[model samples]
Target: MSGVAKVVAFMQRSWWRAALVFAVLAVAFVVFGRYAVPPSTALTSGALALELVGTRSGAVAVLRAFEQQHSVHAAWVSITWDFAFIASYVAVLVLALRYFARPGEPDLIDRTAAKSAVLAGAADCLENLGMLAMLAASPQQPPDWLGFAAFATTVASLVKWVLAAFAAGHALWLAWRKLAQR
Candidate 1:
């Protein structure tokens, strides 16, 4: 088998491991997310500022205000925490689609959906990088690459959510079918 095929086989066999990782990281994301920013501020900016800020100054101002309330260190740590969360989230969702679907030979659609989970995870990682870069630079006078980072972060965040929603819907459908069989 090719390297990619081998990796897929491994993933197919490792659903429980992925679930364990997801459980651990989910806890971290929830805890650090709470300490990183206020719940009200989250409504406005969110973890990676899912809402469009439209301008570099606006983005910087928001980050600065966030840092003032919660130290920049917490914000940085939260961004790092997101990395772990994204990886585990993708793995568990994709593994579920792979192994928990109707018991039969896998089809092209199943494979594609699993791959999309990885793609979504990649997009999320890019989103995290852009957010971290912006947060790191926000303390400066003008903030380096503020426009590009913020724009990329927003776009990636949107892409990640769309793919995530698809995975979630697919998982639910599989779950319903499984339950109906019982």
Candidate 2:
């Protein structure tokens, strides 16, 4: 078979894995909606870290505040998590478009591959946000307020690690391109 035909067949076979991702995301979304949980309030490391720290800074005060406003506030926490998803989604989609379309190739558009990649990335984001949110919103917590300070610190470190990976990836990509041009 020709090169193009071979690639097309490969994608068709692999498409099932991609569909499964979206199906899982839909289930998670339904669960989150039922719980009346916004993704940001539930997920997003930075925001959860903030709440953890804030709760620690003055536990009585934090409890008092949460009790007072938790009932009154709109479901805006999801908005924060939603923003994070958009950012990650765009980055992943850009990377996917580059890979599938392979701009240097004669065909400028690999429409099926490009579209599939974006859908997969979005599903990944939703799943991640859902997982994090569920963790943050869990009923169980340390009996002592001070322990949550430690939780905040741990989350901050994880966020740092995530950022470092992205920065390293970007630097490497740039360096590779520069050397290739030489």
Candidate 3:
């Protein structure tokens, strides 16, 4: 078998390991996300707000809010941690899909769903990069690129969410079908 096929086979057999890593990453993500919340903002609200900020003005507003609450550093910390979370989630989702795939030739839907998970992770990474760029810029004297960054970030975030939801939903459907057959 090709190296890629071999790796996929290995991952299909190691879904539990990916799941355990995902659980750890999820808890860490939550803890860091909580820390990212500004005093004036609701719990984990800042993170979501940052992700959805589609304009330079919106990005500045969110950044200023975090600055006022002295949580800008915390926000950065949380976003950095999110990189690891993205990897864990993508791995677990892909592995789960592979594990549940039917025997013999791979189903096109299963392959597409697995690819979606990877794409979602890539989009998430882009979103995080854009956010990081915005965070590094001063709210009062924001860079000329801030607007483009904000727009791109929002786009990436939306794509990430949509693809992830599709992948997760497909995985659940596959699981249900498999269980029903038993």
The best candidate by lDDT is 3
List, residue by residue over 1-182, the lDDT tens digit for candidate 2: 75444433444366574355434545554554444344434233333433344344343333334434462133235533444454444344433333333335424234434444344444434434432442344123424534454344445435544543444354345446644765
TM-score of 2: 0.31
Model 3 lDDT per residue over 82-125, tens place: 78778767866776676667877768999999999999999999
Worst-scoring 10-residue span by lDDT in model 2: 131-140
Candidate 3 lDDT (Cα, 0 to 1): 0.80
Give the poorly placed runs of model 1, Cα more than 4 Å off. Answer: 1-54
Which candidate number would show the highest TM-score if scored against the true structure?
3
> How many Å off is the CA of 148 in candidate 2?
4.3
By TM-score, the candidates rank as 3, 1, 2
- Least well predicted 10-residue stretch by lDDT in candidate 3: 34-43
lDDT of 1 by residue, 74-130 (tens): 556666776777766775676567555656666776766777788898998898777
In terms of lDDT, the poorest run of 10 residues in model 1 is 42-51
